[model samples]
Target: MRYLAHSAHAQLGSLWLSCVGWVLTAMALGLIQWRVWLVSDRGVISSGVAWVGVWRACFNSHALVTPGFRVMHCRSMSLAETFTPPEIVAAQVLMLLSLVLGLCGNAGGVYALRNIYFRTQEDSPVRLAFFTTGVLCLSAAVMSLVPLLWNLISVVTNQTIEFPPEFNMPPAPDSQHVGCGIGVGMVGTVLMMVSGIIFCTYRFPVRSQRPGGSSSPAPSVSHSRGAAVNDNPAFESHEDL
Candidate 1:
């Protein structure tokens, strides 16, 4: 029923990493700064800026109101709207799925760790629990990574999404750059992978015989020795007499 010598430490490490990763993933999903756009016009020194995310887009315009006055507007993305890009839809779906999986993994990991450290029950399926946790964490990592990478590629390629005229945003900005959300997502994905690998490494300790331990004679050998002594002439003579 014993596990590897370092199994306890490894399990604890995995639990912490998974928990942090889950929190980071949630933050990334909620943040609306996946891509940042910087806008500038000839007449205005500081014109406007916009940002887009999986769930929404926001705009900050200084020239629209008054000189040196900044106004910020945000719009919730709708799947029914034609302006919503396919990438945003995909990101939304995948990020949500990843968050859900991460939550499950964290719960399973806590249960497994509790059984390993607190409950000394030999019948507990700690190994299976660890394995399941690993699978869930890795799946979450993959799900989160796809959208993060896709959005990063789009940002690099200067992909644009058409904003409605009411939002008062340009179709394309003068320049665009990756935002904090993507960076956080990348870090979270990496932590998830590391935690999963550590969980998967948990294994039962192998039992090995000691070299200096005494060995007992086999039953067949003991029986043969007894028969030879009984058949000896000295014992037979006594029996016959």
Candidate 2:
């Protein structure tokens, strides 16, 4: 059976999109600006800004001992810490899981697309590969999306986290908003979903017409036997007898 070139092209496009989504997801997972806090008055805090992410939190503030100068201070987040919010901990776990699933999905997608483009395997194996890749990609998308939406809601509600004194940040800032990390994560999730749908929709094209601009039908066994009998002189003589 012959496959259509357009189908291969579509698979290639989805593969590229999925690869990009995987990279973006990793970026979002590592980014430390999931939520940004804007300080209107510098008198309260030296640098007038702070941000928190799944893995860490950062603040622009004066040092604990040297109060005269300010610097960007970042601290690693821990689930054991009381100041860390449950939402952040969940986000951290889910985002990491999403990254792992996305990696596997990208690898499987590449293998499937390569087989499809080269027509290396039977239809069944190729179709199965596509299905597996689609499932993985979609799963990854959902995993990443949960945390992103949850955090977005938290930001909308203006949720606050307790900060230690050494970091020199307020429990809540004067104003807060979503950060670039969420934006990037949202984009990546969208791409992953689109690619997965495309992968799932794959279908092998029907046999096409021959180069002579006509389709040749397969000859039946009964017709071939009848033609052979009619063409054989010995069979005709025996029939006459």
Candidate 3:
């Protein structure tokens, strides 16, 4: 039992490094917006497509076309513009938390794995490292999901905002569509969750006694001054009983 348990524990420690790698990958992907599209509600002639991402916003107009080509212009979104919308703000915060937590989780997992394989600390530190890794990875997954869902919801239920005639832009589109960014983010979320499960499962360190070691008492030794053979019994000294 001890051998198996110790072996499994060591294997798990090594396994967690992969979890950290996965979590880092997911978190990195989560930072990008793959597919968020907004359609203009304006008439077809005045209608346009707008693409929003975590870092910037882009738009293409169907109104102005030369022969067969269309023009597209992209602009970096300001913090105020990116954060003004309630849903956007919520998503921004959640995704940020996910990234931060993922970083923390990776750090903790690496620390723990090192401690386990290298026997850096006696016992308590490694346990604490595992616990921290689990908590952080779990937190990162949860945080990632919130923003992914929120931003997606915002895309589907979004209403067209009205603009004055002076601005000359069409009505906000009724059928807003999600972009590839959101899809990629969703995928990242799933990966993050998988990593979280691994971290959580191995959070508790498995302790085992050293091989060939036992706490049981030693066998007793008996001493006698008598001969073993009956023929030699006569020679045995029994005080002339």
* Model 3: per-residue Cα lDDT over 30-138, one tens digit each: 4434334344454433434555565544455555433344654444433466224555556667777777787777777677666665553465566666667777877
TM-score pick, better of 1 and 3: 1
- Give the least accurate 10-residue stretch of model 3, judged by summed lDDT: 1-10
- Residue pairs of candidate 2 with colliding backbone atoms: none
TM-score of each: 0.80, 0.81, 0.65
TM-score (C-alpha) between model 2 and the true structure: 0.81
| CA lDDT of every candidate | 0.82, 0.83, 0.57
Query: For residues 1-241, could you state the per-residue lDDT of candidate 2 as single tens digits?
Result: 4564566677778888998998998999889899999887665456777778888777665543233435666777887888888889888888889988888888998888777666656778887888898888999999999989999999999998888875567767888999999999999999999999888888887767877777987666555877999989999999999
Q: Find the number of clashing residue pairs for candidate 3.
A: 11
Residue 51 miss distance in model 3 (angstroms): 1.1
Model 1, span 94-176: residue lDDT tens: 98999999999999998888887777656348888998999999999999999899999999999988888765667688999
Angstrom error at residue 43, model 2 = 5.0
Each prediction's number of clashing residue pairs: 0, 0, 11
